[model samples]
Target: MLNIQSGSTEFWRAWNHLLRPVSSRVETPRVKLSRRWKVLAVAAAAVLGVGGLPTAGAASAAGASPVHIRFSTGGATPPNEMEAAIFSPELQKKGILKGYDKDYTLSILTASKGTPQTLSLLAADQIDIGTLGFSTIALGQAKHAIKGGFSVVVAQFVDAHPGYGANAYMVLKNSGISGPADLKGKVIGTNQLGSASDIVLRAWLVNHKLDPRKDVQFVESGYATQQAALNSGRVALGTFVQPFEAMEQASGKAKILFTTAEATGETAAIAVVARNNFLKEHPKAVKSFLADWVAGLQWLAKPENRTEAIAIMSRITGTPTNVLGLVYGVKGKDYYRDLKGCPSAKALQNGIDAMVKVGDLKTRVDVSKLIDASYLPYPC
Candidate 1:
């Protein structure tokens, strides 16, 4: 069993700092590709100083240095922090993750502020792989913040696919707010200003003929804190995903007003994106990572592994096992994840178009240019 207290206090403090919202007024400076690549090469050299650098083909040789990959994830569930659980030592010992500590080693970065922060990290070359939402992919491309643009390699999770769990918008059961119109003048809580849930909330309000800007107020509250925000009447409505949603519903004090699916159809809410240069320089390692990722998902999906999987998630996230058991890895109860690591281009495009329709984005992005599924284990 994994120990929940294994993480150091300093690590958690840094993680919490990363989770805090980035100020809109502060601009994230973008580094040129050449400079970024030079920095990475220097860092690699520093690590392999004594042995000298080995060629890509020699990566898996005995005593060869492993490729260092920094991966950024947002939350502690299927779409986000699954990599952490999947790559845990326990799972690796069970052979669920075959690539770890082989040709590549992973450093998981927490982007609790969501894709926007991930975008910043990617632009600065702080993270090699990022779990990005459709909106951020489009935004990054439009702004040229991501050097060669986002090269999506795998699907993280799909939101509101058929019977799968969707992000929920909740309110106190006795709050008497039944519909969008009832939300007028009320304070709504969102994980972040441009997060997927926030975009869906705005779109839903517009569909109901209410102007999101004028009809309601939005407060930036973390997902972990949203339940308390709702209970204390700090915010009349709050957006929830996974385990948090399950916890709130089980309490019988909150009720779902609507879901992401109700606002917009199925969405490619999160997908694994790699820096173009990283994909080009480490194709073999990339392939190994994807293969392991698919294998991990398959292992977690098996009924026999359900209990162990829940325990792993609870340890990583500090969520109760019962709460995680309620939704984690349970088909139709958890978000839909593709076993082969193929994300739906159509779903991603639809999500981008929805953002444009809501006036959140000024233009539509060509989904084709943003995705490079050639690195996936299977065809996208």
Candidate 2:
């Protein structure tokens, strides 16, 4: 379980500042690869069998109309309730894990790239629910990028102080990189441009007294393509979450330069996002979905459930059990992963404040607007 401490004064200051009017919107800049790199992205995505969000919807099967909730594993990682319940037979007995719901059927989407693609799908009304990076959705909401009123449903994994958990940036083992100072003028690759990986990397740079805007360049690649790009010498450094993060390190090909926690304490969390209209349009269906979601989290939080949990996630994601265990997240220890589907306001605020300080977000958002807790009727 994560220690959901209150936000620091800096966070409140930033939040309050957002209450005031800003003269202009200062958008964080991202490195755009050339047309050649675009082709590379296509080829890499094809090789991985991943692409933009899926457009799969289902009609009523028997009696109750099926509510389709589309969600993706961020960067095709993080074994959240959506992926776990689909594979875990024990969780299936609880409800959603069985992969068949009386009221809801999941259309699990694959995100070849990162937040932008998923956010676009959400804005276009393509996906009813999305598993998105913490800052991605917050900044998107700040810009009114989402089409309707959207709220965070749960936390997938959260940013914590260094060493508390894993969300790391790695460089090829032989790549002459030691620390943040070494990254100046080098190309740092991450999944999404404006997502947690980007924000934390920039924060890490600034904290080390290097100017992220001038000192280094960011290479954008999808999670699936991240490893290929890193090993192929396309990017000097790469940032990854969960399975992929461990996968790279295990290959003996890369070593950890830093983690998000190391640079900026406890930033970058993942959550389920849903538009208010969808919640209202299908209240009962959404309620049941939330129920299943919580049940999945509960199943994961138990220590004895680890073996089955790993097997289920491995089957669903094709990631080995060793890599998948990190998502289960131990209780009251140095290690923690996943929010068990619930995240706190303070943790989310900490990430937003980091972005605001970094100028990644032009205006501070009313965070309350991004959360709708109605779906979870009781405390998990």
Candidate 3:
């Protein structure tokens, strides 16, 4: 159950928006998860990829409720890297994560919304840990207004390519729009108004000498609806991430514009974070979770486990095996961070600066101080 707290009204609005069931018809891409949680002997999982892992407190002798970390998936794919492993028979065999969940639980504990929502929950102590975007955290800090009560645990994911996010942009086939120049006076859609999609798109435009704010009409189009918006002619261009990006390109109905990698060399995924007090109070439990998560990453990253890994991801996202393999890079060399949980510091700092220069974020955040890497899977 969610115990929402006070925070920026902008975030509250987004929080409420994320609380809807999958069919809510919201403009945002964060669709709700299945409300019915499978009883895993542990706890319940929330709607739309809003799942939680129980902490060490779940041990019977301790007689305390488990630490509930409500995590969210913030991309176009099945946010199931760890979920695939944690809930699978592999992790089940080790029994390393079993202390918390008789069964893994899903929670709608306000962490599903976005950075602001996650921060608010952290500040209020409503949830212990959740997934967040580094850019969001950095931009919020730069503005010097985000609620302060959490520390970064690990880097969530990453995408590296010559022009991944930028080149991943999709325009309807035969739309007559060839490049960034065509979008100068037209509406271009992003998953969120101030997220990776928005910032990356703007940065790509700026690189082309187009002032995103002045030259184009930037609109908020949820990731789920981005494709529809394009087909319906609601927006001239729709930005996508991951499978959504790969899916659109595969559909042959759209064409790539350019590579967004030009702006930020690589795309960093969401991060795992926890309330400062909770992290300090129970370091072992946190480490166990990270260790288990990293173990999962390591298993799936290996070539031998490729088949099961694909099946696991397919089951988690309900995406097909073929699509998962293609977009997620099961066969290809799409390296996921194993023991190394944090992204390149330089890349993240540059991302923060890009957001600031584009006015997406008003302040400059010191990326160095924002992370508490001491608790990560490896030494920082």
> What are the per-residue Cα lDDT tens digits for candidate 1 across 1-380?
11121123443333333333455213544323444444433443322221133322344345465776667775445434467777877788997667777768765655656778788878876667878888888888888897866588888778889988888999999999998889999999998887777888888888899888888899997788899999999999998987789889888999999998888889887788988877877888899888888888888778898898888878776788987888876667788878888878887887888889799889788887777778777775
lDDT of 2 at 53: 21
- Could you arrange the candidates by lDDT from highest to lowest? 1, 2, 3
Best by lDDT: 1
Using TM-score as the measure, name the better of candidate 1 and candidate 2: 1
Query: Which ten residues in a row are the worst by lDDT in model 2?
Result: 1-10
lDDT of 3 by residue, 1-380 (tens): 23222223444444455445546735557533333222221132222223243332343226544444454433334432244344465555765454435322334333333455555544444456766666666754555433444676777665443322232577888889987788878988776766765677788788788998789897776565677888788888997765556557667788877645656666554566666766776676677666666666666666787777778766655657776577554422243443467645565666677786677766577776767877656776
Candidate 3 TM-score, C-alpha based? 0.75
lDDT of each: 0.75, 0.63, 0.58
lDDT at 303, model 2: 72
Residue 292 local lDDT, model 3:
60
Predicted structure 2: lDDT: 0.63
